[model samples]
Target: MFRKEYTRIESSTQHSSVNEFVVINIPEEDVEPKQIILDPDDQPMWESAKIVAPTPNSAIIQLDVDDNFVINSTHLKMILENKFDGYLRADPHDHIREFLAICDMFKYGEMHSEVVKLLIFPFFLCDKAKTWFNELNEESIISWEQMRRAFINRFFPPSLFNRLLLEIRNFSQNICESLTEDWLRLKNMLQKCHGHSLAKGVIIQIF
Candidate 1:
């Protein structure tokens, strides 16, 4: 280690000025300055730069199934084989309908149908849909009904509902469209917008 010593000396001039003199003392032996390295794992407890604690594996949806209720990988694979990425043209109502249909085909003995649907629902989403699901409050959705409502509310907003309602109200057969084709078109539109709640009599009257 090199030691530094400082001395103050006053100049004997008309205007006295104090000058600082520093003397550095070096050891006789040739020595290099020691370099200290800190192990990444041994970071100081108070250090802000310390490695962040590993994030807990939190899920958006909570499953209240029994301990024995194991998720079947085969079912998961089958459900995820077709992913919904929340595209602008993709119908969320149709996606939910298809998802429920797929869930209905599977039988899990004593497990409730809600449990089965809730467990398998997340696997069928990708890209933007998956991102939206993840951004939902942690474990906020625990039931199939709640999940369904949330999904519908997120994808099918009020503006879209109003627009679809207007379209359904103003539904008219085109000059070249047949009665069968026009009826099918109106049915398809209604299907696209779930919970239209328009009475059958009113729908018929509108047509």
Candidate 2:
């Protein structure tokens, strides 16, 4: 039989070599989390900062308008005459279409059509619409398409868009209404929806 031997390990705390030792007291610090304050000027591009901060020199929209390119006062007057005041009954899509129709009549001297639209669009807003336009982020709108899309998205939200779409999808002709009247009504609904993806064949089939 082989003899087994066991080796015991001693704890360093129980068998400390040096009898002398120093315990320097370290005071525990009561640290509090720092509250960071951000200046509005530091966050110029932030939407909330833009809204609350005063920016007198900054324009909400940045246009590619040349300093020398001046719009005719008469044209502006004409546009302002038919200003769209955002109200309960006002259809944003109809307003935009009407505005475009009016703008089509004028040709500014050497200025791009897009520039003309951008310059004249602001004059076309009044009352609630004008207020909404004024509240846009500084230099947010750069192009006519951007302005148009933003305008439509703001005024004609997804809820209104879906309602219009549903109306088209479930269109019903009144029992006593003439076919011509019903057709005109359906056409008007289509116009309001603006970008409904229903095929022409399906639309004719709906009729």
True-structure RMSD, every candidate: 11.7, 19.0
For candidate 1, list the clashing residue pairs, or say none.
Answer: none
Local distance difference test, candidate 1: 0.72
TM-score (C-alpha) between model 2 and the true structure: 0.64
Tens digits of per-residue lDDT, candidate 2, 32-137, equal 3222223333333544343565654323455666778877787788888888888857888788888888777777654578888887898899999888888787
- Candidate No. with top TM-score: 1
lDDT of each: 0.72, 0.72
Error of 2 at 187 (Å): 1.6
For every model in order, what is the number of clashing pairs? 0, 0
| Poorest lDDT segment (10 consecutive residues) of candidate 1 | 9-18
Least well predicted 10-residue stretch by lDDT in candidate 2: 10-19
TM-score of each: 0.67, 0.64
